[model samples]
Target: MRIGQPGRPLDARKDELILQAGRELLLRGGPLALTMEAVARASGVSKATLYRRWPHREALLEALVLREAQPLLSMLEGTPTDDAGLAAKLEAFLDSMLALMGQPGYRAYLQAIVALPQQQADLQRIWWLGPHQTMESVAALLRRYAAAQGRRWPAAARDAETLIGMAIGLEQARILYRQRPWRADARLRRRLIRAVVASFLGRRSAGIAVCEGNVGRG
Candidate 1:
């Protein structure tokens, strides 16, 4: 990890070690304890290595959020071959995200990031403007599905943003009240997607329509 070390070999486990160490530190003592030195000691990686990977504490923490969110992003990728498939993927993505936010690790990470102190202007800027990959991914998934159905959801992005916002807000409230973690209501949320589409298109059955449910009951 020395600077100017010619032909230095990279450790394959470096990123994993650093990120895992960062998570442990954050989980153990929140943001205050997640210093570069702490992560280096915990992971047995050099501070230099940590900086090389992420220029500052904010960058490292942001990477951690993105890493944790990978599964939600994965769930929504690619075109679903049919209406039912599309509806299922979208629902699963929504379900997984809400469920994830209720988990201890991911919830704590979000809590730390979302409520970062006012002094952390840089990190706040990065987060507020967003990588928002999951939200963006959901929007993209909706558009593709609409295309497949030979229709347009004019408000897909706006609705997708609202849906994501609500899921996070619900989990934030749960976190605030110290409620036991919970999962998304799979059938109900899928039905919600159908309802959203129908509202915009003005039919009980329209785009990705039943959301492919009859817009159906479970």
Candidate 2:
């Protein structure tokens, strides 16, 4: 709850409350519904207090977006030492990401941010700091995980992005158009996971050192 003003000091307790209120407003109602006056009322802060910290809606929105995206950085933990481990980790990561995407709050927040005018600096900051950073971190994790297994990282990284994108893309589509659940059957899930892994291995791009000992493509 730093709000936009670094120089102006506020009590930590009040700041936390204001941030909490702002987050609730943004998540539950989307950006259009987020207003400084509304947040002040929600948080029981005076309008003067709200304005003193977050001067505009964009500033508050950006802060919340940053907070939301920060946790995604840790999604790469506990990657398996072998190919099975890697595939499992990838599946888990995709599942977690899809879950996030499917949340109503997340969907609304992303839609609001993306629809903002291109020249809006705060929105640009949100995009760069949040989803863009998550994508970069995911790509980096894929590269490193493959390398740890004595495999080439780039091809696998590419495939990882592709797979992750497919999952997210499909989920987003459902959110936008059909409002349908992204309910993948066992066969479909297996097919997607294997297809991505197969593409990487088939290309010999992962630089896997143990070709003879590990799982083979179908």
Candidate 3:
């Protein structure tokens, strides 16, 4: 019974091995396949070693998903360049998110998390909140961009949610259900990003129009 104590330094290499093994197991056999014994055997680490780091399978999976999502999540907090226009910033954000969700392995991990039983509420919450937080960060960026432009896009944050939902929803569906090779083509990706940005701007314009009409009639 090796208890994980505070200030206990974990071996980076060992941690990587364990996580990698966990991912492989997850991809091969879904969440059900991820057991402490299985991960230990796969990673060549003893079961005690695995337990010391992650007490249960859910803990291991949550950590693995967070580790993978952290890089993209960091980008959500990135400062846009002074000269980068809203469209450019939006394009960059969409590109990063698409790339992250487009990876087959990452998609599999997400699907596994989604498939978890409702009884595992904690794990499910952790899995869902990571992506939800990313979405909120994007909304914040949109609001910031609108402010920078000296324009009040009241719906900027809502539109941001729409943009993220559209991109991720489409890509995830295609990746999970469509039985076809989805190669990344730069041109197509750019087109998609442009369309999403245009949609957001268009929706903002419509919102402004409705507001103006309301004021005129008042």
Candidate achieving the largest TM-score: 3
TM-score of every prediction relative to native: 0.69, 0.66, 0.72
Q: What is the C-alpha RMSD of each candidate to the true structure, in Å?
A: 7.7, 7.2, 5.7
Q: Candidate 2 residues 1-218, lDDT tens each?
A: 45545766556667778889988887766666678888889999888877777787777777777777766666666456776666666666666666566565776776766676667676566667776777777777677776677755545546656656766556667776757655444455556656765554455433444444454651
Off by over 4 Å in 2: 1-16, 32-35, 46-60, 77-80, 155-157, 184-218
C-alpha lDDT score of every prediction, in listed order: 0.67, 0.67, 0.70
Q: Judged by lDDT, which candidate is best? A: 3
Q: Name the better of 1 and 3 by lDDT.
A: 3
Over all chains combined, what TM-score does candidate 2 have?
0.66
- Candidate 1 has what TM-score? 0.69
* Model 1 Cα lDDT, one tens digit per residue, 1-218: 34335564556467777888887987666676778889999988988888888899888877766776778788888887775676567667766666665566765666666677778764654454344666777788877877876866556778778766654556567776678544445566556655543343344134345354433453
The 10 consecutive residues of candidate 3 with the worst lDDT sum are: 1-10
